[model samples]
Target: MSQSPPARKPIIEFRGVSKSFGTQRILDGLDLKVHYGEALVIVGPSGTGKSTILRLMCGLLEPDSGEVLLGGLPLQAEQLQRKPIQVGMVFQQAALFDSLTVEENVGFLLYEHSKLPRTKIGELVREKLEMVGLDPVLARQMPAELSGGQRKRVSFARAIMEDPTVPDDETQLLLYDEPTAGLDPIASTVIENLIRSLKQRGSCDSYVVITHQETTIRSTADRILLIYQGKVRWEGQAPEIDACQDPYVRQFFDGKIDGPIQ
Candidate 1:
C-alpha cells in the first residue's frame, strides 16, 4: 500500500489563545493554524477581533491566556531578538510616513538597522517598487503625493523588503489588515491580484489577510476563516464558501440580519 503524504506543518498556530480589554473578551480559547505556503483570508464583522489576530501574529500584542506559536515554537518577548522568522505586516491604511519619500518609507527598516550604503538600499527599493507595478521615479516622491492605490502598493513593496546581508532574515510570513480597503472596485482588484502575485513570486512563503470585501475574499484566499463572537465560526476552502451552510457564513455572505452573526 502507498504511504500517506506527510502532514503539513503550520507556519503560525494559536492554541487556546484568549485576549480581552476590560470586560470585553475579544478572543476566547481560540485555536487556529496557518499552513505553510497557503493564502488564508479572515473575514468577519467589525470589532470581532480580526485585526487583533494580525497584531498577535506580528508581536504587537500578547494573548491574555494560552499561546501564540511561530514555526511550532512558542512566541516570547525575549526570543524576539533572535527573530526565528521575519513577519511583515501591511496596515489597512497604508500607514506611510507622511513626511518621508516613497524610497525612504520602503527601505525604513533596512536604513535603520542595516549597515548597507544608501545607494544599494535605493536600488533595492526601486526593484521592489517595480515588482509592485509602481514607477521607479516615484521613489523620490513623498507619500502625500501618491494616490491611495499607489500608497498601498508602496506599502506592499515595503513589506517584502529584506536585508541581503542576513541570509535567514527573509520574511517568512506576511500579514495584511484590510489591504484593499477604501478603494474603487478596479483598484481593489489590482491590490488583490498583487497579493496573489507576490506569493507566486516567492516574496513570502505564506500570508494571512484580513478583509471584509467580498471580491477580496474570493480573489485572494486559498482558504477562508470566519471569526465570530471571539472564535472561528467557520473554516473552508474558497470554493466551498458559496456552498457553506454555517449560519455565520450564511449571515455574513448574504448580509442578512436574522442569522447568528448579529
Candidate 2:
C-alpha cells in the first residue's frame, strides 16, 4: 500500500530556537510548531518568554540562534512586511493612543498601508467596530473617554483593521497578548465571549493568547503549553490539564512556587 504524502507543513515553526539578551536566555533551544487553523495557548510563570514568541512571529525580534519558519519557510524582516501572510496582535496594555478617537485608531494602519480613499477607510472602521460590538458613536469618542473594556475592544478592532478578513469557514491567526488583563469580571466575560465567537464564526486558523487569567484560559484555549524558566516544560489539552502529573505543571496551576521551579 502507498503511504499518503506527508501532511501539509505548519504555518509557523520554531526549531532548536534559542533566544537571549546577553547572557540571559529567554528561549532555550525551543522547538514548537503551530499549524494552520489551530488555536494554541501558552501559559507559564512570569519571565518565561511567552511574549517573545509573538515578537519572533511578528519580526519584532530576532533570535540569538536557531530558526523561525513562517509557512514552512525561513523568516526574515523583509518578507514579513510584504503582504498576505501578515498577522494581527493585541498587546498586553491594549496600547491605544489617548489622543485618537476609536475610528482614527482603527483606521490608522489602513490609512498608512493602503491607498483606499478616506471615505472607504471610514466605512471599514465602522464595520469592524460593529463586529466587535461597539457602538459607532463610541467610535467617535477618544480613547480616554471609553472604559477599559471599550479600549481593549478598540485595540482588537484595530488589530483586525489590516488582518486578513475573518471568514465564516477559515481560521485567521490572531496573536493576543494578555487580552483580559486589568478588566473587571464582566469585561473579562465579554472578551472571553468574543474569543469564543472568533473561533466559532471566523476563519481563525489559530491564536496564541498570553494571559494569567485562569478563567480566560478555560474559556479560550484548545490546548495549553506550560513554559517555565524561559522554556516550554509541559503541554496538554485543556481537560487533561487538571490531571497533569508533571510537578511543574501542577505547581503553576495550583499557584505554588516551592516545587521544581524553586
lDDT of 2 by residue, 146-218 (tens): 8899888888888776523323333256889999999999999999888777656662557788888998888
Residue 44 in candidate 2, Cα distance off native in Å = 0.5
Worst 10 residues of 1 by lDDT: 76-85
Model 2 per-residue lDDT at 86: 52
> lDDT of model 1 at residue 88?
89
What residue runs in model 1 are displaced by over 4 Å at the alpha carbon? 1-8, 81-84, 168-171
- RMSD of candidate 2 to the truth, in angstroms, is 2.8
Specify the highest-TM-score model's number: 1
- Candidate 1, residue 25: Cα displacement in angstroms equals 0.4
Return the TM-score for each candidate structure. 0.95, 0.91
For each of the candidates, the C-alpha root-mean-square deviation to the true structure, in angstroms, is 1.9, 2.8
Q: What is the lDDT of residue 228 in candidate 1?
A: 89
Candidate 1, residue 43: lDDT: 92
